[model samples]
Target: MSIRRLMPGRAALRYGLIGPGTHAQENLLPALSVLDGARLTAVAARRPDAAAEAARRWGADLWTDDWTDLVDGEGTAEIDALIVAGSPQLHADVVPRALARGISVFVEKPPAPDTATLEKLAVDERGAPEGTVAFVGFNFPYGQSYRKLRDTLRAHGTVRTVDLRMVSAKPTSPVWGCATVTDSLLQGLGTHAVDLVLRELGGPDRVTARRADIGTDRHALHVLLEYADGRLATLLLGNYSNRLEYRCELVTDQSVVGVLDDFNTLTLSRPSRTPGVGVLDGKETLRHTWPGRRGGYGRTGYSTELESFHRSVLHGEPSDSPLSACLEVYRVLDEVRRQTGDRP
Candidate 1:
């Protein structure tokens, strides 16, 4: 059943905002305004002053500096759900509080800073109200291109191999202001890339990563994930490139599919004849384009993801992104970092 049928529509889903920071103010709040069936009831920041300022500027009904005020105080009941955008450290403390109070949560990525906190969240979620959903915002998963890829793979057959590459200029300002580009790159971009890889390949049994220190706060990483079934996927990620580049190629026995330019493009190619193995020549290529709407931070995809979680919470339906799926990704990150000797 559609999540809408199971819960009160957007209007019924009372939403709140925690951590009224740049991303929340710039992306999430504006996105929430346009998403159907979701309401922005309040906002809370680490500082009461900041929360009050955001509330005044953003039209939120209530504002508090204390996160507990939103989860345990009068404002707590005002919101049936919250989008937790606090720093990575705050997640370990605040997310469980919201869940303990029966409020549904949609956390920003790197849901927690490290493995220990993520593990605790897994346990806390079990005691949450049945059907109370928690989500980690790997917004790319909800992209039209990926949805098509998932659908296509299911309709066609299993993929034999996948190659995904993403290289971009090092993050600027606050992204780099906190940590070296290398540490932040893997934690930030790697999380998104790795999550998508796991989603596409199911899971990787063996993961070996090689890293090169290109510069401060930036490193080039080559990650190879091997599945027990012999399926393999590779990820090339680094903050050293000058241009903004992102693309993924999925190969099946029958056809090769490409998600290019960060899902901005999708192409399909079939070989002229079934070659025994190896790459096909340029002559054996066909392409297909799937046009989709695009706008806003993250292409209006964040709104779609938020709306999905809001509905899931109200109707008592399973979340599109349940905590288990989130935990899987965390486990992957834990394993990868362990192998790479990367710690945050």
Candidate 2:
């Protein structure tokens, strides 16, 4: 059944904002402006001045320095949900509080800085009423190109190999919520790729970790995941690259699918018969162009993801999908740390 049938078509899901910082301002708010399923009800930042200005700018009805006020529902709008866009510590605190109140939550990635906190969230969520939405923002695979690429890989036989490469430029200013990642770079940036790899091919049986120092405060990582079924994936990540670079490659016995240029391109390759066939006969070459990739950040499934969560809440659909997936990402990060003994 289409879950949209459960919601009033005209009613928007009202959601408050906690930790209204740069991410909220740039990504979430801009995306919300173009989507109709959700609307901003309030915004809360660590500083009252910042919150007040943000509320004015974002069109929220109220603003506060203390996020708990929204959780308490005192002098605030009767919100149906909240988008927790702050650091890991704030997410650990507000997410549970909001959920315990039966308010749905949309928290940014690295849901918690540690496994213990995630386990606690699991406990809290179990006690909440069924259909209470809990979503984690791992927004990569949601991109149209990536989605198409993932779906295409499903029919290409068993996955033999997978590669994820991402190199990000250093931040020019403080990135909100970054301070809370256990190992900020890997947890923050690497989470998306980790989540995607596991989602596409099922869980790995075992993984070996590796890394090399590239520069001051910069490093390159190599983690190899081996599945019992003989599937393997290599995650290549680095922050030293001054320019942006992101790509994902999935290879099967008969096909090779690539998500390149930070999702700007999707290239497919498959076996082709060679002309001089004396029995040696074929080579895999670039073949198809999967056509759903969008042009910019706003178009790249950010709004679509928000709309999805809002619709799920109003329609009583299972948002539990992201919750468990999010935990698996943490598990991957945890295992990498265990294997490499890199404590951040």
lDDT of 1 by residue, 177-215 (tens): 234455567677788888888887787888888788764
Per-model clash counts, in order, read: 8, 0
| Candidate 1: Cα lDDT at 257 | 52
C-alpha TM-scores of all predictions = 0.85, 0.86
Model 2 CA lDDT for position 69: 88
Candidate 1 residue spans exceeding 4 A from truth = 1-10, 171-181, 242-244, 274-300
lDDT of 2 by residue, 19-122 (tens): 87777787878887666766676888889999999889877788888888899858344578889987777788987788878888988886887777888887
| Model 1 TM-score, all chains together | 0.85
Residue 84 in candidate 1, Cα distance off native in Å: 0.4
Show the colliding residue pairs in model 2. Answer: none
Query: Model 1 RMSD to the real structure?
Result: 5.8
